[model samples]
Target: MAASGQRRPYPQLADSPSTASLLQSTETNHRSPEAAFAQGPRYSNTQSFTSSGSTSWNGSPTNQGVLDRRSYQTNSVSEKFSLPADPAVWGSNVSPDFQEPDDWIHNPDPKRDRKSDRGGSIVSYRGLTNLGCLVVLVVGLLALFAGYPIIHYFTTNQLSNLGGFNLGGINASGQVPEMIGNYGLIDADTPSSAHTYKSFADGSEWQLVFSDEFETPGRTFWPGDDPYWEAVDLHYWQTNDLEWYSPQAIVTKDGSLEITMSEKEINNLNYMSGALTTWNKFCFTGGMILVNVSLPGSSSVSGMWPAVWTMGNLGRMGYGASLDGLWPYVYDSCDVGTVANQTYNGGPAAALSGGDPSNGGALSYLEGQRLSRCTCPGESHPGPYHSDGTFVGRSAPEIDLFEAQVSGGVDSAGLSQSAQWAPMNHEYIWDNTTGNFDIADSSVTQLNSYAGGVYQQATSAVTKANPDCFDQNTGCYEVYGYEYQPGYKNQSGYISWVANGDVAWTLDAGGMVADPETEINDRPIPQEPMYIIANLAMSENFVTVDVANLVFPTTMRIDWVRVYQPKNAVNIGCDPKDYPTAAYIQQYADAYNNPNLTTWTGDTSAGGYGQTEPKNSFLGQC
Candidate 1:
């Protein structure tokens, strides 16, 4: 240790003038050697250590550590203080000063002097970059505009011939094939099978316009109770049926329209059953109708005549109004004044050949004759008009979708309670020569035999070898469909009767025979809007068994009825008319009051003249 006011001898570091000056400063106001050593050296701006001593640590003119001023010294204190001394600790008397080279203390890879990673050379091609982007945009546009439509066509539009392998060849057109009467085996297992009937023979889709699944448990069918249909309560004098139609016999229960017939006395009829109709509420011109029905009683039981059919809207069921003018006339040539065969005065009139247009009737009569040449009483023809205000003629042309009758004693016609013949697909047009409706067209292929169970008859050809699944009783529901396309004013049109999607029967408008006086082949195509009627009628004409022996309380269940039309086709309903007007009620009361009209004896003016029925009856038009 040096004296308190004296300087200590320092090591001689190589030729460091700055270190010598730093050490000479420490000689003034000198701290004790122990105090100076403990305080260490102050760090300079360059992070090198320096001291204000009488001599530099390197024994230079100033006291300073021998370190490179260009960079920081990162060595440990022991390494920095390495000196040639026996005890090399701090404050030890070291040997002569020796400065370390800049390379030893200056880091070769200092963090601040590192090279950057983003030093690659940039290449430029302006035209090539633009062209590549344009090509990508064009490909995306093509995929959106051209490729999308092609994919959509293949996915949405079904084609039968392009691939040549013939998928759905049996019914490639997707026109419903005439289904076998197999009680519901095929359809019950697959509810989606109904979609198979949603197409036409022309490969067009059918838009469902009306459908009633009968799903509501307590939905009623009385006049104001239903939106689309109504139940009737009357004796069907047109068919001379034995059963009286009562609204109470119709019910919606357990997801079905259950129409039960029982032995009862009503309107002088011993048996009572049910009937439902769309009538004036919902009528369509030309469309397809599909019904799922299980007919009441077995086919072997006689007096069982259950039918699902359509009649011209001009005639109301159970009403004597316009019964003569609209009962079976499809063409204007069969109007009342037009002379045709008739049982008008209890027998066929002789040579009723010419239309007496000079003779006309009331306003109701005139509107009913709008399609005919007959003159009426007023200019306000009170037409039960089409929605387009066209004259809706009073002609009740009939098309039977399905009509089952037990016409034999012991399944002689090969139609038992379990198995039956093909349903009666008959189209009745007025016959001028016969004074009544004649079966101008019918689908009775090879009648008197039960040979065609078939593998889904898609065309008109019958397949007879295979046994059909028609063994189920009346408990099972079967699908029956009818499709009609009207002609364009004497042009050709088409009609088809389908059973369970099979084309059981098909006929062109030209195939139907119109009245000879009409002189037009397409006149019998039923161009007028028609309403639907479903009834379980009891008729003695087809009965081969005793009425007392036949089962009582027989039932018919209708699962649903759906009406569809070709997309964008002309679908018109009955013209708007205030039904059951005071005038109409008066006319109906007058008719009912006439004792000669015994069929309407039960009706009364106080009872609103049957206006209290499931639907009000129009005096002249529907």
Candidate 2:
């Protein structure tokens, strides 16, 4: 209460001394609140206490008012204050004697996680540890399951004779099936279908030079094994071919020569096939060549190409020696003196008559010569020099007797998977004036403008003409023949492609237009000795090949190959005797009264260019 009979403005201590006087006493003495107020009496709402005794605020005496030095007491000095022990009321004013319950934890073994130990096993946790174990188990299972196939793929011979479905009733081993018409085993005793050409064009009789019946079964020709024919072992990188030529792929079985093409990986190549070539052993100039063959797979078998062709002997098979001889050598003189697109030093008289303007009209007599004899740029002299001291460096002049492939562009669009069309033609280098060859771009720059025929697969004509010739899955064996006859000097010549006893295509030297620009009219036939090559290749040039659907272990079967020639026909080969002498060649030139038909000054035409003299082991007679 205030002296003016009004309540104090600030919150007053209910029954204690004034807050101002108490605070001042405590601050001055620096004593506890209880110590500073020790002389005063404490009071509650219903009771009060004095230093004399406990009393009521209304001046009434009460024994219930009890107190202790540290805390308020009820009945006895040991009794605590009668109030809830909530922290809100006690706050920071709690007596120093008060104590709280202990909540600190203790662990003797701190290294162990006791909670996890009591929970579950390690497998129960779904974590990276569990994931790693699962992954390892899966990988192990996959490896175990795939072990056999991986090992077999790497170790086994995929082209083996065993296993796989039948191809025309022949297994992967390429056994000769029953002769269906002329398709099966070639008979050694009988004359071939090409025997009809015995009476060659121009009233000449044919004589057999080389013939192979392949009668001995189980005979195999490995690389460098056979005297006449050797298997080619290489990847034909020049053609972007997908197969590696393997010697083991060529085999003679059941009286037939079988060339197998299969899905076999070697040297990073995805396929394996066979090629048999009579390279350095035997080569011939102008003659009649006949082959009886059954190509592997039809047009449906994409990327499959089977060919029997002749190449200039100077070019080694699979060796990239094309600069030496790749075919189509037009002018014998590859001198740099000649200008481009010009008529042999810009003189029509000189170009046509074998006289060079640069040579002061002197008759070198080597104008229309298409021999691979020039020392052109990058031309290597892989040679056997003649008696006249001129190396026989001839590689141009190619004759493709048979090349089985699908047609190109719209022609192929009209063909079915069963139809196989082959092109029989000759290729010449693009150099009409200079015989230089750009071997790097040979494919696009070559010329095939002469007598050529697309293979029309005369199965009906063939089967009708010869009852013995039967058509099978890839069609029956057909007789493919090429007859080339050298002319009288630079006069008219005769070359014909025969199919089933009929001339399918012919190049009449007389019918050709006399044009200086297009040298094809000059009748540039393959004059040099060309060796034979037969291969089953997977080429991407012709058709889009479905590699996934290609049947593995397919085969190309060859019944027989027989070569014939006329007696008067000048057939030059590797044999030194077959080589024409300068005087002998001049006889024909003089008869035609054509100076361009004559050979070069020192060129004897005795042997082909680049022929090895001491290494000439060719046993064939011209």
- Per-residue lDDT of model 1, residues 178-201, tens digit only: 433211212232345454445556
Candidate number achieving the greatest lDDT relative to the actual structure: 1
What is the lDDT, from 0 to 100, of the residue 330 in candidate 2?
Answer: 28
Displacement of residue 403 (Cα, Å) in model 2 is 0.7
**Candidate 2, 1-622: lDDT as tens digits:** 3323522112125464442244443235644433322333333353222233433332444322222312332232222223335644422346655444344443233355677357665665577678889999998888878976797789996542112212222211223345432222113434655443464457567756566777667766674344457787777765678888988899887767899888988879888998898764556667788888776754333567777777665445565423222323322222321122123444444233322334443322212222323333232333445555544433344566756554332222111111111111112112233221111123212222222111111111111122223222524677776677644225545456655544455544342223343232332444456678999888775456767666777887888887776655535343323332223223233311221222222233531132221211111111
Worst 10 residues of 2 by lDDT: 416-425
Q: What is the C-alpha RMSD of each candidate to the true structure, in Å?
A: 17.0, 25.2
